[model samples]
Target: MMAAIATLLATTTALLFGAIGSRGGKEPTRNPEELVTVPAAPSKPIRTSTVRSQPSAPIPLANLPTSREPTSPQLALIPKPNAERESLLERRKQAGDTGILPGVGIPGGIPGAISEPSAANALVSSLGAGVRKAAAGQPDKAYALEQKDTLMAQGTSIRCALQTRIITDHPGFASCVVTEPVYSFTGKHLLLPKGTKVMGQYDAEPDSGRIGVIWERAITPNGVNIDMESPGVDNLGSAGHPGHYSAHWGSRISAALWISIFSDAFKYAGAKYGPTQTSTSSGIVTQDPFESNTAETIQNIAKQAVRRAANRPATVTINQGTIVSIFVAKDVDFSQTIKAH
Candidate 1:
């Protein structure tokens, strides 16, 4: 029994060893949980000489064609012909060679061209001859000659009827003599109405020699007599109307006579009072103390009043007592005392 048991044990041990060797020979043993995987090495890209299958090849920026620099066109400087210069020189030569016409040599359009000792001598000769011839004739003929001479003298005076008529008929017309102030005064002063009719005559004074006429008129209501005289003859004929000798003679009287009288009255009033002041019914006051430069101030006030009056409704009437304040540049203020009704 012991031998038989030993044989079975040996067989069993040999079978176990054979089975272990078979399993080892069939596959290598490893732990699946601890198994490691390795990746293959990357491959290098292949270089090829084949052209792309599209259209044209792209041009390299450095190899592309460039634009050429611009060039200015050359110009030729040439001188122009001077036909006009030659023409002007010819015209000047022609003008220099020509002389003025006979009648035009003397400024007047008179018929005779006699050379006299002097203009004054010629005038005296004409007057004396005319007077002597008239005195030698019949009484009626002498009287007619005197009338004609008187009419001629009056027609040449500065205070001619035409000028006086213009002044009277159209006081506001620019060309009329009456548009400008005849007289200005500081206080309430009386003056002849602008269109008042007056007569003027020439007065020859040997001492205080003048060739102007005197205008005489009565101041209305006051009944004061006013007279205006013109400057000397030398100044008169220069006024362009030598034909109207009386008008030229009376020009100074017409322009300055009333102005002087008015200025005198203004001076008297100014001396009597301190300064002019005016007030409106609406309580607006204007002080006319003669500030150095009040013209601008007064102008600005008038402008503002005009603007305000324009903006007012149509129903509103611009009348006396209206109050208007003008604000000019900084620090300048003007208040107007309305005068128009």
Candidate 2:
């Protein structure tokens, strides 16, 4: 019982303190001086460094190197020749020499200098003159041919006039001369001047009684003798007739035989039919007698026909002043070598 009473008394005392602490009250004020604020002290001024500049100065020429030559390998300058060696150069210079030095291996050496002509130069000039004279003295090819002193290639044709008259019935052979000038194919060069000669032979044809000719050789104006074959009649142009004849001698013989038989038959018929009458010499009777004997005439005609039937020789004839052409039969060379003067 005593413990309970003591607990009650403690509880009562705590309750009373709690109630007092819980009650509300007005807030209290502080001093105004304590609330006021003060500004900070001012900072010290800042400091900086300053710098100054000066103008540049010029360099002097006396301090530079004097030489302009490079350090690399190059041609060295040749020293002036000694007085003894320079005598030749001085002599050349005195002669108005303006070009490279002769016989010396230098070009454009000195101006206002003259040089004497050497013996070699004079010799060369003489040789040149001689060569020119020789060339001028050479004969002109065209002129030589025009004068007939030179002949062109063979087989060349030329128009020539006959100087001699030829008869078809001439015996064996005759020489004919060409009197007119004959030109070449182009008529620009002469083939034969005047007086070129040719020889020919003629033969007769028994059947046709025709004549033919054959040329053997010719002589040139320059005295060159050339052999030639017999030329064709057509190649002679209008100068001669073609050498040909028919071989029909039997036809002539047969015709002559028939004429003789008819004549005999006519005579026999005239003798059978006659008129009888008294013969009187009242008027001079003029009887026309045939001078030719019938048998004799027939016999002569037969003989002539027989002769014509045999082969006759061939021949050709040309009249005077007739123009003819002849061609060369072989190659001819006229070129000759010329030597140095």
- Which prediction has the highest lDDT against the true structure? 2
Please identify model 2 stretches exceeding 4 Å from their true place.
Answer: 1-151, 165-171, 179-191, 206-213, 220-224, 230-317, 334-341
Candidate 1: Cα lDDT at 76: 17
lDDT of 1 by residue, 67-179 (tens): 65444432111112364345445545533433222223355533222223346555665676688788887776333322221121222222222232212111121111221
TM-score of each: 0.15, 0.32
Tens-digit per-residue lDDT, 1-341, candidate 2 = 89999999989989987777766443557766656678999999787666666766776557767776554543222223574357556656633423334444325433222344466655665676687687779765653333233344455654455566655544566455666665544455555567878776655433233334456776876775656654424354533333334444556557657766755655554445433233436665444323334545665665665566443343344567665565554543332210110
Q: Clash number for every model?
A: 12, 16
Q: Please tell me which predicted candidate would have the highest TM-score against the true structure.
A: 2
lDDT for 303 in candidate 2 is 65
